[model samples]
Target chain A: DVKVTQSSRYLVKRTGEKVFLECVQDMDHENMFWYRQDPGLGLRLIYFSYDVKMKEKGDIPEGYSVSREKKERFSLILESASTNQTSMYLCASSAGTSGTQETQYFGPGTRLLVL
Target chain B: AQSVSQHNHHVILSEAASLELGCNYSYGGTVNLFWYVQYPGQHLQLLLKYFSGDPLVKGIKGFEAEFIKSKFSFNLRKPSVQWSDTAEYFCAVNALSNYQLIWGAGTKLIIKP
Candidate 1:
């Protein structure tokens, strides 16, 4: 079985603070993704990394960035956290061998509250 | 633009009732379809997926979904739903060679015991 773990399950931060959410996968997958999930909005991709030091912006990447210094770890960084950024953050990893048909395994989401 | 559409936002049903959730995509080409479920306080999990070969695919928890290429739809179905089946269902699609998956708004299913 594949295991994806997040650094924090719940977090609270003041406005304008810098926040970091970490994710690690044991499956040695080559693709990692960060997404924010909101009610009615579903999951919006923040950023994705295909390889170490390689990153790509998704549909909604404003105010957020990502780091992939290692294959197992991917981190999501909020440059300046705002109340609008308060939502559930999800991290997913997938084996890139199958192209777009690959199934992504997800971690327990980090619910961030920006006050 | 590639997109996914779920017909219902919320669905309330009693236990043992039949279930059917509609999902459609607006992509023209070979695509992969998926239905994911999020139970209360649980991480999102894949319920079923359709890539090719069989149009009808069965998944865990007695859930199944059928892909209709002509209709551009992959609707989830269950003969009988339990109270434990209550969860938020999301439909997603990804076209061939695309890196991102287009997602639907999701349907919150509440099964009454």
Candidate 2:
């Protein structure tokens, strides 16, 4: 089965601290995405990578950045974590190209708490 | 702009009761639709998806959705819901531009035994 994994299930970070959230997928998919889930707000894309060393900004990329040095791993970075940034982070991967195999599979997610 | 909307903020149903969750999208052109579920503390799982052909799509756990193009709606339904079905469900959309999904706020469903 295809598996997507995130490094943390729960994370606590002090305000103004830099935070890193890591995600890895075993499917060797070409597209990886980062999203944040919040109460009353649907999942908002933070960043996405279509290929190794390639990245694109999603709708809500403000205050966030991402890295995809390798095809299977994608990292989301918070330059300066803030209370408002505390939310559930999800990582997803899919076959970057078109065709019937474009469904995205997601990791369990990381719940981040900034205080 | 392109976006998705889930009308129900919350819903409560008894086990064996019918279920329906409304999802609408503002994007008119070619688009992909999806329904996803998140059981507390678990990752979001795809309930179903609609790409081309047959507007009606069935997914795991007996969940089904109909994509009404004229209405711009994709509503999820299950003939009978179970207590185990309690979770938050999301409606998502991505224009033909690729897989950049725009998600709805989500509906919290609580099924009572």
Candidate 3:
């Protein structure tokens, strides 16, 4: 069984504060993703890392950044937390093998509340 | 713009009831479709996927989905649902580029005993 772990299951931050959400996957997957889940909006991707030090912006990348310094860990950074940023954050990882249907394994989400 | 649509937002049924959820994508090219379920206090997990070959694909927990090319639809179904099957279901499409997925708003299913 693949295990994807997140650093925090719940977090609270004030406006203008910096926040970091960490994720680690044990399946040796090469692709990792960050998404924010909001009601009526669905899961909107924030960023994705296909390899170490490589990152791509997703549909909703404003005010967010990501780090992938190692293969097993991926981090999502909130430059300046705001009340609108309060939502559930999810991290997922895939095998990244080409020509194959890769299923993403998700971590227990972190519900962040920005005050 | 590529988008996935799930018509039913909330559904409630009794146990042993047949279940069917509608999912449609707006894209005219080859695509990969998936159905994901998120139980209470759990992360999203794949219930079924449709890539190619046969339109009907079965997945874990006796769940299945059928892909209709002409209609651009991939609807999920189950012959009988249990109380444990109560969860939120999301339909997603991999189109436009890369591994990025376009997700639907999701349907919350509640089963009564």
Task: Please report, as a residue range, the 10-residue window in candidate 1 chain A with the lowest summed lDDT.
Answer: A96-105
TM, every model: 0.98, 0.97, 0.98
Candidate 3 residue B30 Cα shift, in angstroms, is 0.2
**Model 2 clash pairs?**
none
Tens digits of per-residue lDDT for model 1, B6-70: 99999999999999999999999999999999999888999989999999999999999999999
What does candidate 2's lDDT look like per residue over B5-85, in tens digits? 899899999999999999999987988888999998787888999998999999998999999999999999999999999
lDDT of each candidate versus the true structure: 0.95, 0.92, 0.93
Error of 1 at A103 (Å): 0.7
DockQ of each: 0.84, 0.63, 0.63
Candidate 1: tens digits of C-alpha lDDT, residues A28-107: 99999999999998899999999999999999999998999999999999999999999999999999898988898999
Displacement of residue B6 (Cα, Å) in model 2 is 0.6
Candidate 2 lDDT score at position A93: 91
Candidate 2 vs candidate 3: which has greater lDDT?
Answer: 3
Which runs in model 1 stand beyond 4 Å of their true positions? none
TM-score order, best first, reads 1, 3, 2
Candidate 2 per-residue lDDT, tens place, A85-110, comes to 99999999987767432678899999
TM-score (C-alpha, index-matched) for candidate 3: 0.98
